[model samples]
Target chain A: MGSATPVDDEAALIAQLRAGDESAYEQVVRTYGGRLLAVTRRIVGSEEDARDIVQDAFLNAFKSVGRFEGNSKLSTWLHRIAVNAALMKLRTRKRKPEQSIETMLPSFLEDGHHEERFKSWDEPVDKALERAETRQLVRAKIDELPDGYRTVLVLRDIEGLDTEETAKMLGLSVNATKIRLHRARQALRTMLAPHFAASGGGKATP
Target chain B: MKCRELADFLMDYVSGELPEEHRAHFELHLSRCRNCHEYLAQYESTVKAGRIACGEMSDELPGDVPEDLVKAVLAARKLDPAK
Candidate 1:
């Protein structure tokens, strides 16, 4: 099929698979396996674990493919399975001890001064890229944030999902997602402020 | 709405989820408030930086994935009846 086809071929492919067409199942796996592996690696943070998770996800998808009602995109359905698998794996691992929410709030409150630190986009992209090392620094800092804030930022900002989509994926209210994203941004700004100041970035434009 | 109130609503505003009337209220307040305006600009920039960082790291994932794993996945799929 050409790239411009109108109807979603995923449903048709699934139908073919159910009808015992082997090529359709292979086509689905070939198309989505890499992407699913990448997402799993990001969530699980290990190549070995990601491989296992992707395999399990594929097995689960194979079993449930018949039950898929064509309501959601196939990619999204596969994504949900991968995410669920990774989260289950995470639960079984030894997690870092939980930090108190009270302690988390004070650090976020102290980040109120974060507005003073960005250079506007008029700067050259090369220069911006050089200065943008703060992104790496900020990601490391994101890892330090409370689990609640970190997960929302990863799902929303990093994964490029919209707030409603993220809320649905994470089982949160829309307002709750907004608040978490806000706090996550504030915390990141606080984390990056020092690097921004060190690089002598221009004051944020009003 | 005051700056604090606007700050409370800014995420919803940027996300474009606020009701039209509330959004209008936010813009009216933003028109008069320099600090909130700067705050919004900075917040947007931070989001932009986060996106760039995520894109860069995500791009790295493909290179890091073992080629053999991809081949194995392809081989496994070839045995499926639907594929």
Candidate 2:
């Protein structure tokens, strides 16, 4: 999607990549590197690790270029590799402590009502998010989510992967994936409530 | 339906997977409850904002991808056995 190759030009690019043309490698890196970095960074939740993961993903892509059937867009292929690399890193780094998703989830009163009243954002959320600070806050809150929830949020919500695909990737059932995604979205909503609520979160950035 | 029960179906509700039989019942609760309606609207907004925030990096070049990182990947291709 990002500039490496339009579907029309993808076959030519794949041939060049397969031929190991130095310029082709350079083009591929320049085209997709930033995008891949973005994908991996969110998943691993670390700048340094994301960089390493992208590098590994690129190396792996080159090694397997011959095997690529061109059945998918070049960006999609690279995206998958980057995602897999990030998930693999996550699996290996399981020793790190993760927060419980329960703490971030919504709390219901005895009558099944919200403990806190819901307030609309100071402005339209999409427009308000135009502020870089607000976006950062959102990213930080997302990173704050426990790995299980964060990954589900990233893949299903951000990456736009299907529920079934996400479930298969995470080795969970579709129902389980949906549950995690819901909890993740709920947790993020709670975390961002203060920042966007009409109580003056709009001025936080301005 | 109580706000909690309605909230419970949010996952399906948002995804449009909530059963047809339950949809009317769900809307009835939303139409009657200001709290639940706001909650659903805000919840949907949250999803949109979250996607935009995370996807912003990839759309903008050099957002966070350092110049050196690109060079390093290219250099690695030569020294590594990928060729």
Candidate 3:
């Protein structure tokens, strides 16, 4: 299954699979299973859950394959299913409302870590490495971003969709997407700054 | 436009979404302002870091995904109505 090649002719495969070719179905599964699993894991943040979600996506895709128009690529159609499945799972979970920034700001100021780090700066190269490491420091920061910011970052940055495509996918105006993306980048920058400074590559400015 | 205004628009500038006149105006401000240049660099790095973080995060699946899970997905497809 791991080494299965992408179907050379997705339309042909879909046509065959629609004609009751079980091998074509298997081929589709083998080609897309790992990637779909990866997308699911990113959204659900659990291997078991991701597996279930991906399986559900495949099942849904199979059930609806005959109705699929050739308007979108087969992979895109499959990924849309995966995204929908992931979003449905995410919806089932309860999430606490975000605290107001005014309430949270004082606690951040009171923290010695923030105070000490913001007091100083670092050289540029060290800053870059530190920024890189911040990716591992918290797994859920992206998930915690405001919904508008999170959606843009996830679609454009994480999912590797371009602005135009992301705009279309999210049903947002391009200007709205740009604003969200800018704010998301800024928010993530603020979160990672201390780590970046500590990594010693950021050039200290007066 | 002031450097402060241009700084706020830096991301759009880098993304090439700014109108030609605005792009020209922003660059004109950038050329003369050291602080804005540095700020722009930091902003660029921040965006780059965000992109890298996303890529790294996506690549890092829990190392212990059970082989059976994939098999189960494959097995489910056998009963697929479309198949």
Report the lDDT tens digits of candidate 2 across residue range A61-126: 998999998787888889889998899899999556776878766677776777766767778887
Q: Between 1 and 3, whose DockQ is larger? A: 1
| Poorest 10 consecutive residues by lDDT, candidate 1 chain B | B56-65
Model 3 C-alpha lDDT versus the unseen true structure: 0.64
Model 1 stretches astray by more than 4 angstroms? A1-8, A19-26, A99-144, A158-165, A196-206, B19-25, B55-58, B61-65, B71-83
- Which ranges of candidate 3 are over 4 A from the true structure? A1-4, A99-147, A164-168, A171-173, A199-206, B53-58, B61-66
Candidates ranked by lDDT: 2, 1, 3
Ranking by DockQ: 2, 1, 3
**Model 2 per-residue lDDT at A200:** 27
Q: Candidate 2 DockQ score? A: 0.58
Models 1 onward score TM values of 0.70, 0.91, 0.72
Candidate 3, chain A: TM-score? 0.67
Candidate 3 local lDDT, residue B54: 53
Displacement of residue B8 (Cα, Å) in model 3 is 3.1
In model 1, the fraction of reference contacts reproduced equals 0.25
Candidate 1 chain A lDDT trough over 10 residues, lowest sum: A102-111
Error of 2 at B21 (Å): 0.8
